[model samples]
Target: MRDFDFHPDEATVRCFAYPASGTVVNDESMWVGQTRQASPYDTMTEDLVLRHFALADEWFKLNATFDLRGILIQPGPPETSFAINCDIATPMVRVGEDVSAVDLFLDVLVRTDGTHRVVDNDEFEQAIGDGLLSTVEARRAEEGLVRLLGWVESGRLASLVHDYALDTVGQAPHPLPVEHWDVENVPSVAPGTRPTWHHG
Candidate 1:
């Protein structure tokens, strides 16, 4: 095994994500996001790092876990909302195909500035997915499944799905994009910028 550098100079950065409008960003949507804690031999933060790669490499929508402070960029919603959804069966929470388990670790938040506009919940997930995919290297044709498995174990991602009530294997053979994470939105990055989706 090898060690990985999971350090970000800043706890946060400005970025953009795909909207749930079923279209790739005509233009990048501006956003400010936080970085995860540092860990030695750490892979837990790969989900976040993979997103950074995705953003710099090309347009992509990825599934991820998040701590939404608020509609940092978007505006107010029709009403205030706060909820949590665990046991994520969606691809956003997948450890990998054929190796994901049942467990719940998701959050749902809705808050508005009470003016201008409101952030759509669907859009929020859409943006997060895009943000993660941006950080992660786009899926590989041959190694996509392999990388997914490696990421699952290397990053301690199994904890998220170790205790699912489903009582099934921690794997899903056919993973589908949530309503917003359609394959059309997953773009291939240009040459040179393509990140190597390595697992340590």
Candidate 2:
């Protein structure tokens, strides 16, 4: 197969999910977020150049991965928060479709200055202990997180985000009002089976 250049100006709806309330080791609440992007990939997938990040999130959430429907974002450093606009849903989807809405939460790395870094160690560890994640899967997630930290420390991530936002000027997706993400909503999706597309 030919390699994809991961050209910018593509639009896609992306999701970031966390462990739901009442699950084993339910130390945290649920956070479901989505973004319309000028590129098809998120920071983890874009930075690590691995589809693994996207795949891992889906496996952990036990839900169907949203279809990409667009070009994949290229492997590169992550974009800064300022570079992309995001909408986070409240009362995340945790149980049955007809379940009631609950408080929403996101697993993040918050610096002393109040800036935040998105991270998922808690979910990975909990899943592993619950026998939902294998040793190999946990290791891969750790590796990806470490690699992301390296880019942040070196300041490469900021530069990449700046460049991508600049390049995709006209093609950026229309932003949803920030408040739309705050609704107490439940998702209609059923728990997923092992994905045939998941290699890890």
Candidate 3:
């Protein structure tokens, strides 16, 4: 699980965890990371390249995947390439040396042909009803969703992805070796809390 800081209010920051793996690139305006997924189908051998983008104040996390192996069986067209997660959070901030971001749940699946679908609305609404998310947070999430859709409809997302992909080529190793990750021992940290891991 990837660790993040979830701010419910000005005075509270909760530790939020999500399943993901990648080597992160912290750019001036965004963070780009890439991970590899093995083909789920026994007959396929090629791996899928999943790229993640976290832009400043974008309110959404954009993921573009190159599924060369056709391993992912989703209800979309022949190939779906992008997924956007709308969230209510600030841009990633550095607490000493560790970097993390908050995640509020809502998603959009964009097919290769530019067609797309919004998903996880029920989950977002449920969070609001359960008091897991505030009304203001809900509004921010909705606004983020709208902005994300605009990026899709305007073809700006495609351009952004293409440029970022080019910028990341050979920048880092893909599919970060899990053998080197010690997530179980990684302590949870709140905003202003110093990371316990030593940088040696």
Candidate 4:
């Protein structure tokens, strides 16, 4: 443990600001290794973004989940009737637990760490987890590029991914990752606001 020197003003400053980076879309799938590969910061290609949709679909159909909370696995979620899916969420990104095999609702599920738009002590650790998850996402973003780059470089992804981006689209519906919630430098989603600059 570190030592504590809690004078009034110092303690006050510490209380308000947490040990953190600005929040943004943080999914573990974006990160790779110990580094934050691709972030909303890096440039993204249409195909690179599209592949993530494919990966998320494959993983969902196979019931594969990469929970950021670590090694926990999801037992099969309660199956929903094939005829009744109206109760599911709207803009209904990915279908939650409930549906027949052929009845899977495959759509683009955009997970934004929108919750990070504002900070709170309740999910501070979760925020850090989102940042780390960037490594997973960045890799996903450039999985193909990395593969190609790997072929060009030492012939391996284990080699040339010193920097990657972690902004992947998913089909799973779970609690938002840390980075998704914060939007310090991002643009506004206000009325008449069109998506001008595509960062991630």
Candidate 5:
């Protein structure tokens, strides 16, 4: 197991273990992680890098990458894309020693053209119906979605990504310690105590 994990729902958690690297920033207010793997597209020979940005108190976890060649095979120039995971709870939490997780519900994909698409409505509703998420959590998720869409609509998402990427460049990623993990039993952050960041 690694220090970083992502929980798509209460029952599901994916850890960024071995071969993946990450680091905490701004007094543990943020976590940046990256994994490099072979390109899944036949048209590309270069490896693909998937980077994750998890900010404390935010309602979403952001995954950004420049590997658009596979999906945009007809591309004229390469473009970066952002995948936002709208979380039902605090976006990031340290569940244990060197271990953190993000609880997610909905997803939004932002393209380079300023166009975006929201997905996973069915899953979100299913989670609610299945009692996986409470009414308040669902409402929080909805609010997060609205804020995220506002970022997209105002072109702020692009700028945020660009600025964060620039700020992280040349910073070497630190390896997470591996240990026996139990994602199913990870602890939750206390309500009303979640840290937040105000974007200027």
Candidate 6:
């Protein structure tokens, strides 16, 4: 804890802004270890839900996530199925002492059907052009992206995901817990907005 520069007196929810495809995808949630899982919220039509895990070792930290929307985690051809994905290390910044935000750059989306695609290249390029990220940082992200892609092609990424979740799923700590609620009842604000939720 001493080495960690940012420390909060209590758990604070932060809004993470993600510009994906053509629009900005915002998730407001609390930090759980190195990850943040957004609270279930309603958008214009459907619901948006996600869980992200940033795992670290001595060399580098890799990010993996289960991103889903709508009601159930339907199987098979995936009509709103579970997407288990890994990507380059998400670059983040501390908004305050308690809250942090990260950029999901060049993520490799690996689905349950053993199919894959690389996404968010335009967003990553935009980040670099806008001076949101430096050349070195961009290079690091690119390198990480390549490494993750190689893992995916070699079947190592799936193995890593299985091993990681199997070992840590039940053991990892949850710093903030969302109260049980239906989709309509879940807290929601405007798009790209981070709601202020304090846990004492």
Q: Which has the greatest TM-score?
A: 5
Clashing pairs in 3: none
Candidate that scores best on lDDT: 5
In model 2, the worst 10-residue window by lDDT is: 1-10
TM-score of 2: 0.33
Better of 4 and 6 by TM-score: 6
Q: Which candidate order results from sorting by TM-score in descending order?
A: 5, 3, 6, 2, 1, 4
lDDT of 4 by residue, 1-200 (tens): 00011111111111111112211222322211111212222232211111111121211211112222221122222231011111000011111221111101221111111011111223323423544223332233234232323332442321212122223222222222322211221112111221211212
lDDT of 4 at 82: 16
Can you give the TM-score per candidate against the true fold? Answer: 0.19, 0.33, 0.65, 0.17, 0.69, 0.47
Ten contiguous residues minimizing lDDT sum, candidate 5: 191-200
Q: What lDDT would each prediction earn against the true structure?
A: 0.22, 0.28, 0.54, 0.20, 0.54, 0.39
Model 5 C-alpha lDDT per residue in residues 37-120, reported as the tens digit of each score: 555566667655455676666677776654423221121233433343333344666654344644546888776666777878
Candidate 3 vs. true structure, TM-score = 0.65
lDDT (10s digit) by residue, model 6, range 1-200: 00011111112223333322111112232222322234343332222233343333211133444323222121224444335545454333224332232333565666655577777788778766865554555676777677767776888766654442332332222234332222222222111221211110
For 2-45, candidate 3 gives per-residue lDDT tens digits of 32454333244443322343445565567666665664555546
The deviation in Å at residue 3 for candidate 4 is 32
Score residue 61 of candidate 1 by CA lDDT: 20
Model 1 misplaced stretches (Cα beyond 4 Å): 1-61, 67-139, 156-200
Candidate 6 weakest lDDT stretch, 10 residues: 1-10
lDDT of 3: 0.54
lDDT of 2 by residue, 1-200 (tens): 00001101112112222222211112123222223334354544421111111111222211111213322232224343322211111122234321112111123332222344654445545555765433444454455455545544665433333322232222223333322221212122211222211233
* Colliding pairs, model 6: none
Kindly report which residue stretches of model 4 are placed more than 4 angstroms away from their true locations once superposed: 1-69, 80-187, 196-200
Worst 10 residues of 3 by lDDT: 191-200
